[model samples]
Target: MVPFGRLLDALSEVPDPRRAEGKRYPLAPLLLFTVLALLSGATSYRHIICFLEQRRIVLNALFGCTLKRAPSLNTLRTVLQMLDRDALEEAFRQHARDLLPPAEPGRMPVVALDGKTLKGSFDHLNDQKAAQALSAFASAAAILLAHTEIDVKSNEIPAAQQMIAELGLSGVLFTADALHCQKNL
Candidate 1:
């Protein structure tokens, strides 16, 4: 899990997707709110909005800002839609890396790699398949180190390779299913 303060600092680096004109809320606060809401068990945007509404004062105090009001569902949707997803993921990984403790002498960290499908993400009406993702997990910390979506046209093997290369993981023991048993890796 990411420390809240570090999470804020990392997320603050992401550029605001909204235009300056008539912008009511800052991106950092909004993103912070969303993350907090998710941590608090919000499963959907409506729940996030509701959570923010119920904890508006506390959130304002925690953020040290008078947002005047919580963001609406539409605001959240628009921001999520427009935000650069790659940048957000990079920030998450960077923050997680910062939180990791140094390796012990002659001991390497254990990293787990796996592919899983997101539950209930299939668009049944449109006959779309569920989303698949390959994730690198820190076994000790029990936190996600990095992940990448497996494109519909592609397979988890390539996604795993890409994610591993992107993370540049070294001096760590990686455990994955036999599907990742490639000579190059």
Candidate 2:
């Protein structure tokens, strides 16, 4: 596959889940479009398809393709469902790294550790809890630098510490809610 730009180049590293003969849209662009739509408040596959359809013209220009129409909701859903989770996460991490600004000599990065439970993640039939995640956000760049799932959503301190240790972060200011200020944490 041909590289588009920094973001696309990084994203394109992930192998497409769909077979070559069955693909209608390139994986990188499709993933990027989904990310864009989600960031823009698209809450479902239907909303993502709508977001793409409404922006088809601009998307053609942005991706350097002549798409007659956006993909269907089924297409988007299937592609997403079959994607390799680890590969997608690595691609997103690369994209996030590209979006971050270079460190200034005297400035410390402000990272906010925020937790959220994914919508529609609860499974009553299986007695499962909602999926939760703690993300480290770059306050200045407004980008996600890293994240980890909170196995137990009630306490994010462990997840936050894990993310910080995994990133090997230093000289950084961290922020979070009062739940993170417990004596044991």
Best by TM-score: 1
lDDT (C-alpha, whole model) for all candidates: 0.85, 0.81
lDDT of 2 by residue, 113-142 (tens): 899988999999999899998898999989
Q: Show the lowest summed lDDT stretch of 10 residues, model 2.
A: 1-10
Q: Could you tell me every candidate's TM-score relative to the true structure?
A: 0.89, 0.76
Candidate 1 lDDT over 1-185, as tens digits, reads 33877888898888777778947888877888898899899999999999988988987887676787778888888888898999999989988887778888998999888999999989989999899988899988888899888998888887877887888878989888998777885
Error of 1 at 88 (Å): 1.2
Segments in model 1 whose C-alpha atoms lie over 4 Å from true places: 120-129, 183-185
Pairs with steric clashes in candidate 1: none
- Alpha carbon deviation, residue 112, candidate 2 (Å): 1.9
Shift of residue 93 alpha carbon in model 2, Å: 2.1
Model 2 TM-score, 2 decimals: 0.76
